[model samples]
Target: MGRVKHNMVKSLGKRTSSSVSPTDGSKKRSTLQMDLEVLECPICFETLTKPIFQCDDGHLACSSCCPKLSNKCPTCAFPIGHIRCRAMESVLGSISIPCPNAKFGCTDNVSYGLESTHVKECIFSRCSCPALDCDYTGSYRNVCKHYYSYISSRSTPLHHYAFLLYKASSTVRMNISDKIKIHVDYTNELLFVVQCFRESYSVCVTVSCIAPSSAKVGKFSYQLSYTVDGDTMTYESPDMKRILKVSFQTPLEKFMLIPHSSLRGDLLETKLTIKKVIQV
Candidate 1:
């Protein structure tokens, strides 16, 4: 989505694609900041994206929601089409605010003109891992750190369980003692990613079905087993979706946090399997 600022500004709710650059935050939010909420698309209530649209009376809507309006503005009930909200866009460009992910160690305070563009590729933006029953969300950097740490803590040997590979060339089979991880893709099949997370001394296992959020996947389950001291500990959960959007099928922190001294040896071996439930 590139910005397309027009030379001729249209109406109040009309939009332009020019550029503005400024950076400020960590201070009190001005009234303008709060008032900016008015610029949100009434349909989705999200800040208007580029090519903002408006009705004859200047009611604003996002480009996405505009086509769905049946050529009528929600606010004024007027026929709406073809008009851009240039005035509102100019106002938005003048505002400088912190990135929404500022709390997550993002030190950027960029101008509103490029806010959406920046956020689309913001490094500070948090994303979820595909692991089932996991709630880990952070930057791509953090996700890498967490993924490697978790997988290495409870990896298995690939030689023991040979499987099909989508692209064997780039997919290197790496081992962490008994743990193994390899990447694969399928043109028309669900891909499973076995993820492990270490909490204190306990280890959590997640069987991630890698796919898109919109994919219609059936419910599934995964199991993990390990013994500690003299007691056997096993954890399992159902309803694993093929894709994880924001949160996990189960909680990560408290699900399987076990004691470090409970393992028979320093290495903790775990097993995982996934099956989609079918309904007749």
Candidate 2:
């Protein structure tokens, strides 16, 4: 089995010989194709990059995981994280690939082990679709287009408010969002997702922006107010969270909490005001 795998790798290397020649004929490069699992740390199963450490018996580990294991090698039960694995570091440094988000408008070529880190910070990284039936995934801009197109046919006409890039403040009437149901609204370029669910005897209303993690839009604060029994109830959040997906399993840290008594026959009429905060 080992010999067959080695022969396969050699075959791949030979296949790239003609293609890797530079136009100027100044140099030749060959692509090494192999299973990436071999480059992952056994402890964390993450790509191994710089500062890799090894045990006395040649068991390797990443730096972040070494301390958790108490500097002991799991394979050989020997002292670890003391000796540097320069060979592995050199191998990792030599291996580079285009960013996984390259097709999504990212034009970076990153080191092999550092691809995961780069993708996390890449603006072009794809965000998951919030809809349950949709399997769409794309960059932030593309995701917005897809979301708008998907909901456009079934969407009710909303009161459009022009949100200024520098300063924005708007108060709008929000229709009742059924219990444990999702409602999506758009104000200018931003999309707002609202969800309401019965929690014990109270209703929990959560509102968030469906955007990329690195969106440059300024911070937003909101105030939700509703009238019940001729009295007014209000909930305010200093900052609204941004999410890539609609998640019901995780409890939101900030949300509007309304008592069951505030409901008017399974209906809740609310008014929402959103303002963008300016940073000095």
Candidate 3:
């Protein structure tokens, strides 16, 4: 009976040792797996790219991860400020990222550091051409051209003319007709009159009896009348004079005159002149 008891005890000891070995092994394997899975940023499930360290603690996070969190860590409530993590960042710098919008149209994949910039400037970004039935897909410049063509096609028929005026010793004369246009003149204000029809037009009229250095000289006002054959529109006031003088100061390159042809009906002829300026 003693021998039987002895044998049973030995068997039980062997069984216990066997079971303990596997448990210890399994625990070690599990720990290693967890360590392999640890990554810097929780926001992006991937390994940290462009890792940034917290100011309060030496905790590391991904660059893409920090913005979503409050200025502190929820775990420690440490005031998290931006600090570079050279080690983690170097690791992330080696990673390549597929374009986030690859499914939309972008075909290029770039390093994680350059991903945001490339995506922002991607040419394949979806944009609609405002022109009807024109399904054009290209860069920004191409899209601009498409809109320009649309405007030109829809433009109303109009004529444009311009003349250059040079200031002489005693008088001013029109040197050459730079441009002329049939334009729709809206109400004439002191500074500008809204013209509707023409694509471009300008007229140059010279002012005489002005001192070169005097800032107040050569100021004048003129009543402008628009008459096409018999139909007439007249605007006369001190304001009209101010508008013409202002036009002279404006660069010719920036000048745009709206034409009458762009209007619904009837053409109007117009005459403009400078009245006088108070000598200073």
Please tell me which predicted candidate would have the highest TM-score against the true structure.
2
Per-residue alpha-carbon lDDT of candidate 3 for residues 1-280, written as tens digits (9 for 90 to 100): 4344334333433210011236554533211111212333543444454446664676655555466666666557676646776766654454444665587666787665465456544544433442334566433334444445554576552223222222211111111232223111111101112232223443322221111112322344444454444565554444222111112233332222334342334333346543444554
Best by lDDT: 2
Q: What is candidate 2's CA lDDT for residue 16? A: 14
**TM-score for each of the candidates:** 0.42, 0.59, 0.29
| Whole-structure CA lDDT of model 2 | 0.65
Candidate 2 lDDT, 200-234, residue by residue in tens: 78777776766654536456777777777689878
Which regions of candidate 2 deviate over 4 angstroms? 1-38, 48-58, 62-71, 79-97, 109-121, 152-188, 200-202, 215-219, 225-239, 258-265
lDDT of 1 by residue, 33-73 (tens): 14444656667666666778889987778888777888788
Give all candidates' CA lDDT scores.
0.51, 0.65, 0.39
Least accurate stretch of 10 residues (summed lDDT) in model 1?
1-10
Which residue pairs clash in candidate 2?
Answer: none
